[model samples]
Target: MKKDPSIMKENMKWTLAMDEVFIQALLDQHYKGFRMDGTFTQTAYNNIINELKEKLGIEFTKSHLKNRLKTLKEHFKESYDFFRNGKLSGFSWNPFTKTWCAEPEVWEQLLQEKPEAIRWKTKVINH
Candidate 1:
């Protein structure tokens, strides 16, 4: 649905200024990924800001936009060891699968062999 101009203005007033909008975008990109089909991509930071300008009628450049997103990632990592290990899927510890089962298997496979990670995680989880 198209936002009414007056309502859009009110939303803008309540929203944080550009650059400061990092955390939400970072989390959104990490978790939400894409919303408008494939408008968002692996290199989506620039596209997202450009589209946001059209959607929100606010302007931001690619460089600063990326910087803001990077800072948000840094903040998230600094605050959590789970994120440092790239585990941000937010699952309760399952004794049967000590690892975050909420995460996709491919995500756990990034560093080591998939089967090994699964086996190790399974043991830790049960141990």
Candidate 2:
């Protein structure tokens, strides 16, 4: 039996969407490297994006995803701080430390978030 190319394309679309909805751990590893504790500033992020674009033979980046997620994080942080500490600093710090002290949870969260960011920047969000 043969399949239509259009049908195959449509199926692929749904498959990719589902993949993005769920987290991909392998890609998540890429995000972990961008961890903020001691690596990856904004400039560095841009450089990484450039390299990825070259490798992927396409355009777009995790920076776009970061912008959107940053918005979500900022709002949540403000709400949390308002209730917990009555303040939300605009600045964000990597919660991780050398020994799982300050930001262990943060590091875990990054594993999820970074992959989402890459997907969003490359696929979901448009320029």
Candidate 3:
């Protein structure tokens, strides 16, 4: 059976982090800066985890942080000309802003390039 392009495109939409609020907070905090270094830091990672435990009552792992950031970056690529390389911090680190700016654009041309059915779907928290 042939796959429906719309369904395939919709599925292409990356799964949302289990803790989206926390993920968004992390992105807003760590992924938005004009520096010459990677956005994520060891200190920041620890602090964020501590904050999550205290406020959200969740014990997150280092792998969780990495996965959430990757998913967030995937969303940015849907609307922007984003690039990344290397592992860990190097994955989403944009050398230009020295942070995690996606260089997002709202141009109709670019948006038109994407399928209309594309959207995000949150996954249940397994952690």
Candidate 4:
């Protein structure tokens, strides 16, 4: 069966500014006790959505925010693991470039096993 185009949702693209605003809004709501047991309440999500719309002039749904949060968490976990794991020792984070710095040989071996990690050489996650 063919799907209805009008009813389908398009992928949401979040800009860095939008993510910053979203995180700020989430933090604000968290301080207000909207987060409990490591999960955001519905009110918190609503507040974040409203804040994003007000600040960025863009409409965002709870699913979009949740998905973005998941992606952010995944990236954070990967960075944390890469640094914390003893196998990847001798690497330092470059605050100036916001990227991880290490010997060429170190990166070469890592990239062989995890090619997707190449993004960290260029892109930095601010959060």
Best by TM-score: 4
lDDT string, candidate 4, 1-127, tens digits: 9864532454587788888898898889999999999999999999898888788887777888888888888888888776664346667777777778788898888788888878776677577
Model 3, 50-114: lDDT tens digits are 77667666566656766766766665663233222323222244444444322234323323564
Candidate 4 has an lDDT of 0.80
Q: What is the per-residue lDDT of model 2 for residues 7-96, given as tens digits with 9 covering 90 to 100?
A: 333122223333242223224444666446644456556654565445543343454435534554574554344324322222133234
Q: Summarize candidate 1's per-residue lDDT along 12-50 as a digit string, tens digits.
A: 322444433444564476576653563446456765675
Rank by lDDT, highest first: 4, 1, 3, 2
- The C-alpha TM-scores of every prediction are 0.33, 0.27, 0.43, 0.80
Clashing pairs in 1: 98-125
Candidates' C-alpha lDDT: 0.48, 0.39, 0.48, 0.80
Mind sharing the TM-score for model 1? 0.33
Q: Which residue segments of model 4 deviate by more than 4 Å?
A: 1-10, 85-87, 112-116
Candidate 2 runs further than 4 Å off: 1-27, 30-32, 38-60, 85-127
